[model samples]
Target: VLSFGLAGAASQLLGDMAHRLIPVTDREAASLVRSIRTAPLLFGWRGSTPVDTPALEELLLRVSRLVDDHPEVVAVTLEPVVVAPHGVSVLGA
Candidate 1:
């Protein structure tokens, strides 16, 4: 699942969301990332700077791998993730 909203927005109020089955392929991850309504923000809306979206896809892939490899793990939550021009950062996990 992927969702975006104003910073510090509640999970339920994210407004835009996308979801796909786990153990996602690279293609699926990329599709999932782009499927979000706010995806244009990552691709440089208007004259704004674009963020490292491929890095976000990679992060999703890594999270998928973690879940696929660890059956005991039920869920993962990464909050306040910062997506910058060069990379993505997880402020909380």
Candidate 2:
């Protein structure tokens, strides 16, 4: 089992929330990143439109690369993960 701990108790407190999960693999992850970076499909969800998905995906790619480069980070566990159709907001990152 993987256990995750939070720091900055008060400052980082997420205040309990819920989220929808989307399972993704390495290839799929890369593809999703690429699509968002290159396409405009991330717009128009609910009452929001043009959410700057490309920018968000680029950030996610950076995080992915950072994790891959750091060999010492054996496992990663983060929360408050937000995934929209065209973008993702990694609140815990």
Candidate 3:
């Protein structure tokens, strides 16, 4: 699953979640990242520096690989991930 929302929004908020089988592909993961409703924020909305969206996409792929490698891992969540111009910070797992 790929899930996210505006910085302070709730988990179950509408349009903030997606699901897929294990071993999620690059294309699939990219789609999920693009589906973010607040994606404009990642692209330098209002003159702010754009977050490194490609880096965020890489993180999603890594999470997919983790689950594919470990069947025991049913879910993964990263909360309050601060996306910066150059990278992202996973504040909570």
* Best-fitting candidate, scored by lDDT: 1
Q: Which ten contiguous residues of candidate 3 have the minimum total lDDT?
A: 2-11
Pairs of residues clashing in candidate 3: none
Query: Which parts of model 1 have CA positions greater than 4 angstroms off?
Result: 1-14
TM-score of 3: 0.80
lDDT value, residue 53 of candidate 3: 80
Model 1, position 39: C-alpha lDDT score: 75
Clash count per candidate: 0, 1, 0
lDDT of 3 by residue, 2-56 (tens): 4545554553555465566657788877777667666677788899888888888
Better of 1 and 3 by lDDT: 1
Predicted structure 2, TM vs. truth? 0.40
Can you rank all candidates by lDDT, best first? 1, 3, 2
Segments in model 2 whose C-alpha atoms lie over 4 Å from true places: 1-30, 33-41, 81-90
Residue 64 in candidate 1, Cα distance off native in Å: 0.4
Better of 1 and 3 by TM-score: 1
* TM-score (all chains, Cα) for each model: 0.86, 0.40, 0.80
| lDDT for model 2 | 0.45
Over 1-93, each residue of candidate 2 has an lDDT whose tens digit, in order, gives: 122222335423653222112333344444553442223333554555655555554554455565567767665655665556555677873
**lDDT by residue for model 1 over 1-93, one digit each (tens)?**
333232534434666667877788999888887887677877889989999988988998888888888879887888878999999999999
